[model samples]
Target: MQPLLDAILHGGPMARRRAMAKAITLLESTRADHRAQADALLTALLPHTGKAFRLGISGVPGVGKSTFIEALGLYLIAQGHRVAVLAIDPSSSVSGGSILGDKTRMEKLSVHEMAYIRPSPSSGTLGGVAEKTREAMLVCEAAGYDVVIVETVGVGQSETAVAGMTDMFVLLQLPNAGDDLQAIKKGVMELADLVVINKADLDPKAATRAQAQITSSLRLLGLHGNPEHAHHDDTLWHPKVIQISALRGQGIDTFWAEVSEFRRLQTANGRLAARRQQQALAWMWERIDAGLKQAFRQHPQVRRLLPAMEADVAQGRVPASTAARILLAAQFGKAPETIE
Candidate 1:
């Protein structure tokens, strides 16, 4: 593990790739021992983490998210930046298998010397994000990747989940999306720091219209509507809409420029630091809640009574509150007094 840590921190690019992969695999493990080792590795690399730019991208199934991401990845590599993409694929609800096919999807970018592509399964999470995505991002950063892009499966509340973890959240939309704001929920739109109208080359007019409609709709939401909108007057960053044809690599440079601008403004205004602090606290609470639920489910007494309590409540033989009290009390080694 020390050798691997050294390779991750000081080895040449070629050696770093394998070490990075091995380290990330450890981080993703559910085994109790692997988790402890993963924690130790994270402590060793803590000083190197948080240097990368975290970006989250999502869109509808046909919105060209892969094309856009690969295009942007290639462009960033050409600019001498090492990129890490955490592509989250939907898993089979029945078989619990994931195709992990993102490397195949981004053929050129996947093999780029300056890019690392990893595909992870959602494992039944609504967001389709790997449970260890945040840890993986830290590992990439520690391994000298300057850009970490987390791509979600783009369904339901997944977009919001991605936004909660990344420094910048980008939402991609197709040209026809202009006709119906209903295509994306208002809540999701508000989450975006920037919006891209992809496949714009297919219909120049439609793309233009979509950009206008989205920009207008954003303003109506009162989040990114005003150009002067800022957390502070000097470092204001008003979200805006842009058109791009990712497959053809059109607007790729402009896209990066806008992203750079967003970073600059956020970094200057202290919002970037503030947001990351908030995310860290939020992540802690989420894990604590999950741990408590797991402990409750695995408690010996609660496990013994849960099924019968559930049945009684379901059949109206007992009230839900009474059943809950019974189960909770059982966890603490005391029986609740009976209710009428």
Candidate 2:
């Protein structure tokens, strides 16, 4: 155990990666012993964490997300920063795991020495992001990675989950794709810290016009998106929209500059620390919720009561709510109100 701790604390690159991989596997395990070990590892590593910039990127399908991240990651590495990309792919419920094939898409970044790429499956989780993705980010930061990028499954609701975990949420889009005025639904647009219009090199003229149209539409909706920092004195947070061609590596440097500037503003205004604290608290509650669920499943009374409740509902002898109350009473061996 001490050797393992030393490996995690003072290991070289390969050793650090091995420790991180082991730590994540422990985090994902369902065994009680593994949970204890995982908690210990996180406790030891906690102080070494939180230095990396956590950025989340999401978009609709076919928004060239992989390509864009590769371009952006490589650019960051060239600036002498270590980068870690944690991509959460949509999972297959039938398989109970993800294909985790993002490495095939991000070829250049995957091979770069300064970049660490991890492709995690959604694992039937709502966010389509692994439960340990945030923990994984901490491990990477402790291992000396400077930037942590989380890429989420692109559906609107899934993107919201991703947003809660990230410092900056980037929504990517292609010009002229959705509806008239390059229309993205207002619900998704409201979450964007920055928007990127990709595939600009494919059709330059059309892309330019589409960007302008989308910008105009966003402004009309009171978005006025411009990637500005909102401090106590200023509540305006205007998201920035930039045209980029990930495949052609166009505008990536400028886009990264915007990201750096945003981070600087956020850190200066204390938003960065506040956001991290909020994320940590949310993580704690999530663990509590998961623990309660596991406890319910493991309790013998609850397990036995579940089938009986289903039968009562099917027979119309009792409403589902009443059945639920009875099950709760049985599970706790007390009145429902007392249980709560």
Candidate 3:
């Protein structure tokens, strides 16, 4: 563990890549001993974290997410910054594993010395993210990477977990989306900090029309939903839509300029710090719930009683609430409330 940490923090690019991959795997491990070691490693690396911009990028499967991420990553690298890209692929529900094929998609970025690309399986996690992705981001930050991009296999309705953890959320849209609310109808649209209509060069007019329509839709949503952003102050950032050709690399510079502006405004207004604090608290509770669930499932008495109770409930021989009380009693020595 010490050697891995040293290599990650002080070694050459190849060495750091090896060490970083190993470190993230350690964090992703569910073994009790590995979890303990990972917790300690995170504690040691805490001070070195929180220095990067956390960006969440999400779009439909064919929305050119990889193209945009690779281009943006290279652009950031040329500006003398280390960039790390983490792609979350959905796991096969039957096999409980993911294809993890995104690294091959970003061929150039994958080999760049200034960049690190990791493809992580969602492990059946909601939003298609490994529970440890956040830890991996911190590990990258500690390794001096200043930009961490979390890309999701955007599926289903509404926002994924990426929106909750990132400092900024960017939603990619199709060029000819037009005024179709169905494209952004899911609650997910409300979470975007910025919207980009990619493949704009393919149909410039349609792209422009999509941009205006999305902009108007956002304005209406902001009015009805995010009242805080409705009357933006100098420090407040109102979500804006832009057109970009990720493949051609057009508008990359302009997009980054907006990101920089957001960082400045968010920092000056204390929104960034406040948001992190809230996220930290929320993360703690999430972990606590996860830990309790693990304990409940693993407790000897609960384990012994679970099958029969599950069968009884499934067979309609017992009420679910009654079964829940029995499991809780086995673990807690008493139910919180009377069940029957």
Worst 10 residues of 1 by lDDT: 91-100
60-149: candidate 3 lDDT, tens digit per residue = 777888889889999999999999988555543443322245556677888899998877644655532546778899889988899999
On the 0 to 100 scale, the lDDT of residue 316 in model 1 is 100
**Tens-digit lDDT track for model 1 on 1-340?**
8999999998887889889899888987779999999999998998999999999998877688788888999889988999999855554344342224556668888888788887764456643244577888888999999999998756556677788889999989999889998868768888898999999999999999989998988777654445465243656777789999998999999999999999999999899999999988888888778778889999999999999999999999999998988888888777676422
- Could you tell me every candidate's TM-score relative to the true structure? 0.91, 0.85, 0.90
What ranges in model 3 sit over 4 Å off?
Answer: 92-100, 127-129, 156-159, 304-323, 335-340
Clashes in each model (backbone N, CA, C under 3 Å)? 1, 5, 0
lDDT per residue, candidate 2, 1-340, as tens digits?
Answer: 5566677668877777777678777776769999898888888888998888889998766788888988888888888999988866555344332214557678888888677777664365653244677778878888889889988755436666677788899888886643464356557777777878899888877777877766655564552433332222343345667889998999998888888888887888788889889977987787788767778767799898788778889999889787777777876788866644
- Cα error of candidate 1 at position 34, Å: 1.2
CA lDDT, every prediction? Answer: 0.83, 0.75, 0.83
Name every residue pair that clashes in candidate 2: 225-239, 226-238, 226-239, 227-238, 227-239
Candidate 1 vs candidate 3: the TM-score winner is 1
